[model samples]
Every structure is written in structure tokens, then in C-alpha cells.
Target: MTAKPARDPRDYSWLPADIQAFIARTEAAYPADAVTFSIQQQRAFYDRLCADFDPPHPPGVTTEDLTLAGVPCRRYTPTAPRSGVTAIYFHGGGFVVGGLHSHDAICAELAEGAQVVLIAVDYRLAPEHTHPAAYDDCAAVVDSVPGAKVLIGDSAGGTLAAAVSATRGETAQIAGQVLIYAALGGDPSLPSYTRHAFAPMLTRADVEFYGTVRYAGGVAPVGDVTATPLAADSYEGLPPTAIFSAEADPIASDSVEYAARLAEAGVPVEMTEEPGLVHGYLRARHMSEGARASFRRITSALAALAAQAVAQ
Candidate 1:
């Protein structure tokens, strides 16, 4: 049964069959109203969803857990690590759910893919810790990493990574940043938002709900850069950026607009729109061919940035 549209009609027919299957399996394993459940209940469902799709850690990759500057973090060190490049990843959970375990497999692969030490920050969640809590925790972890750093994140984590990159500017230590299916506070009225409003996996209502809970006031702060990267005063001084967006996700336009702004401000930025994919498709890398291709591209970008070989 297709969800009755609250705005424009959504067309899932354009998605690849594998992605459709991924969505079907996801919906079957996770309730559509999971977010509406109590916070504890929501986490239970999210954990189960993640477990169902969790892949084993990449061969030869090792992980260590630590509290970086008071924030719990998991670091992945592949067999061969980049000389000085360290990638810091923040997981996406709509600013509420998700923690270290949620994105372990993805982070492990990222570490191996880029051949660098990758640290996944388990930032504090919302309706409790709230806005700056997550931001501060991520910032602390970034500061903890020595030498050249590459910031990476997905969904809400993408927003945080972009925020961190913006603050560091075109600094020597900031090599690059990567955002995946991130909702960078793009206008909710953007074409992607409308077209994919009811696309499988995530919906417009879900976006609004996250926004409301992100801050203490039950709404996104009016003009905060960290809370909303799109609200930044300028994109200048930010380092090279690689943004990967899912074609069927409502927040895809955020990547488009962000890359355009970065280029306009003289920042080297690359945006890849993954066709037939939806938000949170990272878990589908092994399940969907399209997602696997996107993951390869993501890892390639990570490798290039680590080498500091991205066209400047």
C-alpha cells in the first residue's frame, strides 16, 4: 500500500529493483512509525534495523574504543594506514537515535577503503543533550585527531561534518570533507524534498520531526551555522568537499545546493548523486549494486582526499 501523499505524488517506479527490494526489506524489519514511539522504543527498533543489515567488519581491520575529550568514540585502523591523514566520521540518526554500534561496519570499511585511521564519534543525542552537545562532541573529537584530518558524516552527521569543515576553513590540517545523504538544512521546499517527500525509507514528516527535536525549543535555531550548515555566512575558507547524495532522498538537493555554494565561494567540491538510492543506503552497499557502486565512489574520494591529491 502506497502512502497517501501529503504533498505531491511520489514515484518509486524510477528506483532500481534492488533498491526497491532494500526498501521493502527495511520496511518489513522496521516500523514506519518507529520515530513516533517513545525514545527507548525508537532506539530498540533502530538497533534491530541496523543489526539486520550489519556486515561483518572488513578483514584485517581493527577497532579500539575510547573516550575522546569526554565523548565516546570508536577508532578503526586498517592494516595499512595513511601517513598523516585521519578521517573522522559522525553517524546519522536524525539527532536522536544511533550510536557507535549503528554505523560500525560502514566506518570499518571507510577506514580500510581510505587506508587511514577513521574515528566514529558517538555524539550525544537530542531531547536531552540537544544542539551544541552533538556539535561540541564532534568538534572535540576533531581536535583530538593529530595531523591532517578529513571530516566525513552521513545524514545528521553530514551536517555536523560540514559544520566542522566550515569552521576549520582552508586550513593546513583540514584536508577534505565528505557528506553522505546529509540534510544540510536545505530549504524544505527544494525540488528533491517535494519529489521524494514520500519516497521509501524517509519522508518529509520525518525530516520535520528531527528538526523539531534537534534544538531545545522544538525547532531549528533561526541562524545557527552549526545547527544548519546552509545558514553559514559564507562558504569561503572551507576545505575541499565531496558530497554524495541519494537520488530518491528528500535531502538530495541539500548536497546540490551546498556543492554549488562551495564552488561559488572558491572551494573545491564534488557532488555525486547516487541514482536509485534512498537515505540510509550505506547499509545496502552489499545488498544493492547501485549502493555498492556509490560506496566504491565514496571510498575512492576518501582515498583521494587522504592523499591530498584532490584537484584544488
Candidate 2:
């Protein structure tokens, strides 16, 4: 099948006014070439970027910084009683940047929205640490979280969530997965990759660069399900999934294709594309109506998944 055509610059004009303003403000603070900076600089900048758009922490929520099975994590607990469900989140930074602190606000909002406990893993990063390290860290935390759990992540973290869900399908531990604009395994030649290769925030080249650094040691096999879940032989028996894709993201096709594969595998899946939004739109939830709507959908999906786990 032919890939979707490239998006026209004019298409951005159709976005909500608040989204447009958010993008403008973001561009002014972070230039396109910012990705070329050193890893240290990138981390600092990313942390600042996340902080700049951070939504207010919901009232009646408590946060705790702790480690799960040797992996550092930050937990967000809503004031309301827990439903015995937990969401293990991996932060998006292409497996190179981002940490528990970077995604603190997002996790808090999600916890408040879903009324479930949220644990954001601060997985090991690349260049210093390699492939299996980050994957291993995330898996460790996932394994530690007992009982019903949902895997949730954005971008690189999304990849980890999918990988863990597929690799551990036999355990029946995960009830569902929520991937937000995930960088799931997809061919760079796909339509979305070509069309949004140069889109704002994340680009095709940026994705490749991050992958290179993430697997610098090359210890893990390229076909390994833990490294690339999309390359898995089968997605059968996996839990229900919700995938959110940004219409203007280079990896948009990743989510689209993944959802299709899951459906074919007899796994229930829902895929939603947010128009006029770029990669990392989760950070704009407080500012963009479109983002807020998407956030609500995500929370609703998580809530449903939690209920399903309780009923079983």
C-alpha cells in the first residue's frame, strides 16, 4: 500500500489557536538546531522544556521518589483510594534523555485523571549505558509492580512499554498499554516518516541519531523483541492497547501500523491521531484544547483497562 502523502505547511494553520500559540512559544525558546548539542546540554534543555510547559500538580496527590528493584522511580498517588492498579511509565527521550523528574508533572496529571497509582521509571540512558540497560531497567520495574498493571509511555518510553508488553505476554501481567506518539519500530521510508521527517520537535534524522546512541554497544540483536517490539514474530495474547499519534510526527506511522498489527493478532486496539499536533504534544495538554482532549481519552482508556483487570 502507498504511504500517506506529505503534510502541507498550510495544514498547520488549521490547528487550534492555542496549539498554534504553544508551538510559536516553544520555537522561540528552543531552536531547531538544539538537537546538535551535547548530551549534557540536551538533558538540561529537555528538563527545562518539560518544566516550562508543566501543568500544575493536581491537588490531593502525593509524590514519592524511590527505587523499585534497584531501578529509580517516582511514584504519584492520587488522594482517592487506589483501585489496586498501577501504571508503569517510561519517559520519552529517545532512550538518551529524560528521567523521573522530566515526566513528573505528566505522571501526576495521569494519576489524577485515571485515579490510579503511577510509577515513572528513570531508566538508564545511552552513550553511557547501552540497549539492554534501559530495557532492563524498565523491565525490572515492571516485574516489581505486582497485580494488575498498565504500561504507559510516550516516544522512546512508548517503545519500551510495547517491548515489555510483548516480551512478557505470557505472564498476563499487563492489562493494557497506552502509547502516546510512540516511536514504535517503523521503517524510515514510511509515508509519515517522509512527510514529517522535518516536522517540529522530532525529525527522522533525530530518531535515527537517538537509535544509534541508544544501541551504541550493539549487544542486543536487532530482531530481539525487547529491543524492537515491532519486529516481534507475533503480537498475539498481548493486552488491549491504546495508541495516540501526532498527525505531524515522523513516527506517526509507527502507531498506526502497530495498532493494525495488534488488531490482526486478535488484540483489541484503539488508535487516535491528533491533528495539527507535533511530536511531544503531551507536554502541551495544559495549553492546547486538542491536547487536553487527547489526555482525557488516554485517561478514559486507562480507567477502562483498570476496571477490566478488577472484574477479571
Best candidate according to lDDT: 1
- After the best TM-score superposition of candidate 2, give how far the Cα of residue 127 lies from its true spot, in angstroms: 1.5
Clashing pairs in 2: none
Question: What's the true lDDT of residue 255 in model 2?
Answer: 92
lDDT of 1 by residue, 1-312 (tens): 998755445667768888888888887767877778898888888889889988898899999999988999998999998676789999999989999999999999999988989999999999789898999898878887777888999999999999887765445377889999998999988898888888788888899899888788787787788889999988888888899999888889999999999999999888899887999999889989999999999999988988883333
lDDT over C-alpha atoms for residue 286 of model 2: 81
Candidate 2 C-alpha lDDT tens digits along 137-188: 9888888888888999999999999999988754838888999999877878
The per-model lDDT (C-alpha) reads: 0.88, 0.84
TM-score for every candidate vs. truth? 0.94, 0.93
Q: Deviation in angstroms for 17 in model 1?
A: 1.5
